[model samples]
Target: MSDMEDCCDLQLCLDEIPSTFNLEKAVCNHGFFMMAPNSWIPSTKTLRRPLRLADFSASVVVSISQPPGPSSTVLLLRVHREQVIRMLRLSERDERNVKEFHKVHPEAKDRGFGRVFRSPSLFEDVVKSILLCNCQLSSKRKKRRQEKDGANPVPAEMEGEEVDLGNFPSPKELANLDADYLQSKCKLGYRTNYILKLAMEIEEGKLKIDGYEGVQDAASCRILIKGISGVGSFARASVLMCLGFYDEVPWDSETIKFLKHVHAREGCTKKTIKSDLKEIYDKYAPFQCLAYWFELLEFYERRFGKLSELSHTMYHKVSSSTQMREFNHNHVL
Candidate 1:
């Protein structure tokens, strides 16, 4: 069986490690890390961000045996360094990116914006972006009520469902599933067809979704994602950001809320958005996406507690409702 189909779990040992490898900072928020709240292993006061062997990519489950402390040597799941960089965006090589970002925003000198959470596959990133586009803040209280009632989105495997790979569904699995079953069970809404089409095309080898990894430019990535059904500008931007491009900051109602809450930028409209984003985040330049996300992480850390210490149940309360509205969404982490 391919790695995606086996139950094998392993630990990664690294030769060279980045100085900014804090597990607390890396897996801070469910939204930031793409990990389900329930999936995170617990931690006590002394030990933060306790090691857990959750799904890494496709079917490779491994744990980070060590946390980022005084040591320069980091331990991770035994994946290629390129794959690690693809997921966490952290490596010794990323020090330059972090240094450049800090040069623009001096306040972030100590804060670790070095890590940005992402999915194991570009397809998963695109799928989650579709879910994000459908999110609404119209009823925050109602969303919380659903979670409090134990109505959060369940992983495909946890839905009394099983496959050769007990993690995220492979494209073959997704392509074979009944469309109606995926929609109602996963609460995918109109995105069902979009996701299924992508899965089908990939499974048949008619579309080369994986090949985009070789395309180094974000603009090209955006164009590539735009071709998929139901992928709008926001979704494209989001997928690009996850692909480590950061060419644009995918803004939504949450962006408006954060700007008003933090920067006191009232009356931000479409005409004013460019200026607003520029004023607030342009200083971080090419790394503006990371800068914005780091600020969110910082805010959550102070308001809530360190995410590592919080139970997955409590984490569910704060995770995006949009995340809870999809099928197999939890597996995206």
Candidate 2:
């Protein structure tokens, strides 16, 4: 039997979440939550995803939900407790960040959205950043596609049912995966080698992605993350944010659109976003990303309604909703 098959599963109901941690707000706070393997059940207000074991030998699907009532929240995890805690932002470090972030953006404090969710491990976050880098190969960059994927759009039959999503692979798993398989199966395009190299480096211990978790400085983390192949300034910022350093907000074409449409800021493009980051988000200081995300969450909810109520199938609309909605209104779709 395969290692995954050999691994015995455990029913873990960890109520270790912070009192202020809102499951829906935290899980649906970021674009990563909508990606593959991270399934957010709107009806149940639960997050279901596969978490790789600490040793990377196997993975287990974890259904994390904040059940209503007197009992504490239960997460169906069978892996390391630390992994679950970190993924759910239950660690002391996460608590400190949330506390500080709330102080920076008190508006978000009341909204219960300071904890931006991330992958279970640094390797997962790194690979996820790579996958997000060139999403043109995926559904992210589609221009003239279905606009009915977000905000109360899922097919009626699919509601209240669990949709099986793929697992986010670890360094060891991806390192062993064939390049051709990655290209054909994942449609990675030019990013295949970058991912392969990163996976191999992590598996071989040549690249210490996890060691930087202890480093609190975003600059140092950005430099180290940028050193990884395929990681640019934007990806570096994103990885840093995942590492609990929210000082930097990654900017791209989407960011330009968000600024132009949401904030009515003209002359805002990818070329000028980095220089404009401070002027745009400095008020939030170390919680700049959270501040930026707060506006995004506000804009999203205003445009399409509360994201928490958005169906999982419709979650695809989120990444491009701002741009797509404006485009659809102008042009016939």
- TM-score for each model: 0.78, 0.81
Q: What tens digits encode model 2's per-residue C-alpha lDDT throughout 1-333?
A: 344533344444445543666667777777777666666667777676666655666556666666565345554444555666777787778888888888878888888878888887787777667656645323544533444443345533235354444466666767897888766664566777888999899889899888988997777777787679989877787788888988888777777888888777788876677767778789889788889988888988897788778766555566643322222222211
Give the CA lDDT, 0 to 100, for residue 56 in model 1.
36
lDDT of 1 by residue, 14-75 (tens): 44444556555555543734343213444421111111123433334333435445664554
By TM-score, how accurate is candidate 2? 0.81
Worst 10-residue lDDT window, candidate 2: 324-333
Which residue segments of model 2 deviate by more than 4 Å? 1-18, 69-79, 137-166, 320-333
State the RMSD for candidate 1.
5.6
Error of 2 at 42 (Å): 1.1
Candidate 2 lDDT score at position 172: 73
